[model samples]
Target: MKPITRYLGVFVCTALSACASGAPLSSGKPFDLTPPKTMMADGIFYSQRAWPGTVPMQVAIVEIDLQTRGLSFAVSSGRASDASEYRSQTTSTFLRESGAIVAINGGYFSPVVSAEGLGQDAVGFAKSNGRVVSPASTPQTAGAAKAVVCFDRRQVQILAALACPDRFANGLAAGPLLVQDGAIKVDPKNATRHPRSILGINASGNRLWLVTIDGRQKGYSEGASFAESALILQALGAAHAINLDGGGSTALVYRDPVQGPRVLNRPIQGGVPGTERPVATHIGVFTKAKPKT
Candidate 1:
């Protein structure tokens, strides 16, 4: 996928500085819940809020009924040669185009490197609908990732990569698991706050959450750290959760009966008309159209 505007580098640089000398972490509390709004449809629900009194943070959450809807992974380009054609788009483009009810960016991989199956794509693995769309090799280094999360549409699981089963109906391997069994799992060293996108599933495996927290904008939202994200998910009822490709790549889109398709969060990067940064993959929730009666 393509990189975002120049400020992204600055965002990272500033993040380091702030991490070293920022105020104490947020108190574990429920979201402030102002401007309360929600949307509900067949097997889906959406809501948003802004946490205040600190540095202000914006977050959007979508809950999908896995039993009534479908959950799967998608990529802009399916073939190696067509890689350039489908590199990036706003999360909504993938959602609206794929007709998904809920969606978020998937996994981490350099498009150019992955296109040739060279670096992580050569090592990291992704599979969609029972086929090995991306291959895997030795994990390069131990603890390269804190956790590996995958799903088979019917169920999603989190664990060490070595313990992850061989294949799935559709899945992605990306993490630093934010919440496990409803407990926060952030390492103190990785506790820096930044805009974050996270995915979570309930113990029942029948409900899923797609979340995004906006950051890097002063007086608007400063973002969330790995621990904050975990607390947020747990507050929303996630028994298991994982952080996905975040930073400027964080994006969330929802379709409304009246608003149609809209980007619910203010994506920090090239999210202008026809300019959402491209990403390696996407996770989406869709429902099978019932046969006509």
Candidate 2:
């Protein structure tokens, strides 16, 4: 559990300044989704914006340089299975417990609401630290979990669920692939909006982006559709991206050395604002602390 201050930086924008002009920040075409403020560290950058639109939205983005030495990724693991039960925890809990610098909610799971998200099971394939935590769901059983992302110490691969490999150091399934081979894969007709969590990679595959869009809170942040989410990632330079488990489980947590673990988004669960829903799986990022200045 190293102190995050050695590897984390903080920056923020006032709501007044971000929305004063009532104009979206430049982010190419289709839509304007870049956050006004950006926080940067040695190998990581974080940004969040209060986007104004017919449906106002709030978004948080974290980009990490995979080529940075000592960087690693992890997926939450559960107890051995006799049945198919898995343990669950909030994203913030996962960040703190796993000693990861950043963490976000992972794939979809059953029993949307539970006492503590115990006895839950991932809706699709899940592997943690080389262990097959759960197998891929069959076509009839797979709903939103249509794609998978697998990663090792130095590489990451995104593939359709059916093509997922038998082994990977860490991986999870959760998507209707948003972008593939630098093209938008999300159908424009699928316009349903809700809070969202997405994972993406740059064309070179040396950068990884994690995003969370807050929604369902009228007059604040209403959320974005799959198409919008994909466009957002495109604007951020992601060539490939996938939607993760969202809705009440949409959350991104960062460990701030000074402030401790903090939830970067206003998550609404069970109709309660700021409430965090315990979820079945989470993806975490680790990095070596920067040398003292």
Candidate 3:
């Protein structure tokens, strides 16, 4: 029988106890092996795999062509609880409503005590097209107000959380920075295991990596830690990467040729399989289009 894919949106209470015991699969080298299946269109790359890992990991990579595809942050429904109070939406809903070809859940939010089934409060530092979508949600807490990913007109950058200014043209703050200049930075000693969401940029900065590791579901996928997730992104060729809001907030959306747009991985939700947690922000990918002149 196929592995079960449903998961309740809850944080994995305990660490793997062994996630830090072994080296990353593939020796932390770029995975040169061709994907079992591949699809490329509109400059977007897609691959499917049950990645080789200590856990039964499921993954779908959406590599958007930054040079061709339009990448931008979309506030959930582009609406807040009170239109600036608390914004939120489903990944699928964000995709369909924003007309995004694909989308990955954005950075962290408030009232989010842990990674799963946590309450979705206000947003962290999130900027779109040079506008602050939400102000700093917290008062410079540790790992707070940091913009792990920054994209300017020239190139993308992986900066420290505090490095991000109050606002920028485009950027989001979420992470333990994974790779910088092609080197993995996550501490190998990290042993926690939970679902993961990563956003990365390749050597050329043209290809963006949107990676999701399904976890919290037994027999299907166990999940990945900061170090393990770093290894995964590095192997996939991310010159610079950031761990996004992971755990139950980990979600990926893609339009299936046959099934149309849908969340690909089984997100942990209320201890249920295939349930989704509403999120505060989403970085969306749309078909190639000329910038409005």
Candidate 4:
């Protein structure tokens, strides 16, 4: 119970780019998702479009509770935007006002654009748009990131880990709330699942489950990660898990509890910057502080 290093100065000086141990077995590259045209206000849910400029930039995911308290794990870049707004600032201004460059500590690390940011505290992988991507910039023999064992918020809620794809680079899949009776269907070439995914999702009470992890490697953080998709969401019963953003920075923008907030994921192209910024340190927003009648 002693591993607390909370440095939320945001992007400390951006430089990183050192990861890579192994994993990569795909000879059919080509994934698709256009995502654009969005709206959801009054507490907001985001998506004005732009996301890394198109072609599924790098990754994205957002699942805020209602406003802010404990369940708001977001992830962006790959032309980022997971809209469910409740702003203040920090998390590197949602990854540099929507162009991507947070580069370490949020979910699947990578975004070190630094004209003078990130400063120090190094990890690895930066330089988006021109391309560099991560999971530690792979190619060692393939297969490294893999530790899926969730439900550890002190050990029964969900803590999640799945990062060793050579020590971590991208293939995130944060947790809590996925209720289709929970879910578990592993085996993405299993070697433990290399940072592959499946996170816990309880959202402080029982939000169900609907998490995913299958980045499919393209340049970096190569193959078999997501740790059997976070042990298949802790064998389908997530308590509380972590790890957001995945290759092309995995995207998941769902807000349809009956149009309760109104914007439901499908971002890509259009002035961008609704909000997004990978390579994080700490950002878990949840809101519901208005009850006392």
Candidate 5:
């Protein structure tokens, strides 16, 4: 795909800086849910918040309007002939190579430590541009991989893996479905916290949200549990959401017209800050060029 010629200035904000103001978290916690410092474009908003709780957390978010005329989605495609065979690349690389305005790491996969993320297989079902890149996993293999989000043009829907249709324009499976029907669905007993990547949509499914929470670094951003993640999405008004591949693989990248592509969150791979792990799949978002004024 050709890269977008029209460039937009992108800004990265820290917890201390003031940005635009939005609705506070519905939980009523002291979360500093400020609006984005700047709008990336029409229908795209970027923002960050500092949650000074028992464990401090930093979050990055990109909300896109599905109704945007030129909005489209792409999943990383591998060169392997075998659907199971997969290669990994950093989220930023996916963004640049795909010419997407926004990119985020996708579904869980077998870990591959190489810089290229080679010799890896997607842990669950994955499809790219109507091709089944990876098949669905049995519950025995990945219980969390039971939920899937399907995309067809500007329309999106979350479905159980078993309920997924035989055909879809694009889709990926990753879960422990975080939210459904405006309710949190993660196991309450599960309290494990790590850096997380989440995809969510409003009840109307016309708005899409991509979120990343930085974690594992003490005194900075400690991370969030499954419940906490769900709550954050709920606060942002997501009626349905799913957890994507996270931890060291948690990465979000944005294309700045001038700076090219850049990582939005501080990704920690192998305990090193700013390190990006190669992952099996990524979701890239593209927007059509704006009309000349």
Candidate 6:
């Protein structure tokens, strides 16, 4: 079920129907591996999963073509108290202010890997003039003004959380994590999703690598592990990739399948909720560069 097809179904009814209509047989099923078309525009690339599935929460993954431009990532809490606010914070506010297009949910939490820091040990070092200074002394202290910014650089970035005590103790302790450059396959004793095979794939014709957590979630019945999702992204030609926020918060929005640009994925808790928690980040897609006019 391609996203375009599923999104087409949503426009005809309330967005909630998109999820309710699918949950009967698809609540626990994963998407099939049928590669979908990809397009690039306005410094961003857009692509949807080949198969259709309900996310049951708010989330998205977007790749900001930062090959020649600078980029940054941050998380914030809003007054509206819903997932849409988080998406707007990244797309309309954070990204707009900094001119960064790509964003995702959930900031990577770690001592050295906070949204405001460098790599675990700086193996593939890149120069940066501006620093992502901490907005608060602690994560609990972060507020609406809190954010993380990445200085100008040309590398497939990795945003991940440490699942173990020594997730990145040494330069190579991060695990079998796939980055935009390549796969840093590391074995961990405290594997969070141990016994579950993950899928890995290189995107952007192998320029980006995308990894996903909670592959066994409903829409990913075909996905039993993160590795499986990686393969999906790889088949899509991601050069380097990493997992974003998944589970109940995994939502994807796109243009209307039958019409035009519209919300493509279902992102709500049980299809109803007063206010959703503030997501750390989000992902938004746009067209590739425009022709000279």
**What local distance difference test score does each model get?**
0.61, 0.78, 0.64, 0.28, 0.79, 0.30
* Number of the top-ranking candidate, with lDDT as the measure: 5
Candidate with best TM-score: 5
Q: Compose the digit string of candidate 3's lDDT tens values, residues 84-174.
A: 4344576777777777767888787766432333335544666666666665545456353354576564356667664355444566778
Candidate 2 similarity to native, TM-score = 0.85
* Residue 113 miss distance in model 5 (angstroms): 1.5
**Residue by residue across 75-184, what tens digits does model 2's lDDT show?**
89877853655766888888888988889999989878745646788888888888888887888888878899998875888887643576568999989899999888
Model 4 bad stretches (over 4 Å): 1-92, 95-180, 192-199, 202-205, 208-224, 239-244, 247-284, 288-293
lDDT of 5 by residue, 77-187 (tens): 766575445777888888888898889999888866757846688877888887787878877886678899887778888876733576667888888799999988987
Which prediction has more favorable TM-score, 1 or 2?
2
Model 2, position 12, has a per-residue lDDT of 31
Q: After best superposition, candidate 1 residue 192: deviation in angstroms?
A: 1.8
Ranking by lDDT: 5, 2, 3, 1, 6, 4
Candidate 2 deviant stretches above 4 angstroms: 1-41, 81-84, 290-293
- TM-score for all models, in order of appearance: 0.75, 0.85, 0.77, 0.25, 0.87, 0.42
If both were scored by TM-score, which would come out higher, candidate 3 or candidate 6? Answer: 3
For residue 224, give model 6's deviation from the true position in Å.
4.9
- By TM-score, how accurate is candidate 6? 0.42
User: Cα deviation in Å at residue 33, candidate 4?
Assistant: 36
lDDT value, residue 58 of candidate 5: 87
In model 6, the runs with Cα more than 4 Å from the true position are: 1-43, 51-102, 108-154, 159-206, 209-224, 252-264, 270-277, 282-293
Residue 32 lDDT, candidate 6, scale 0-100: 32
Lowest summed lDDT across 10 adjacent residues in model 5 is found at: 1-10
lDDT over C-alpha atoms for residue 265 of model 3: 75
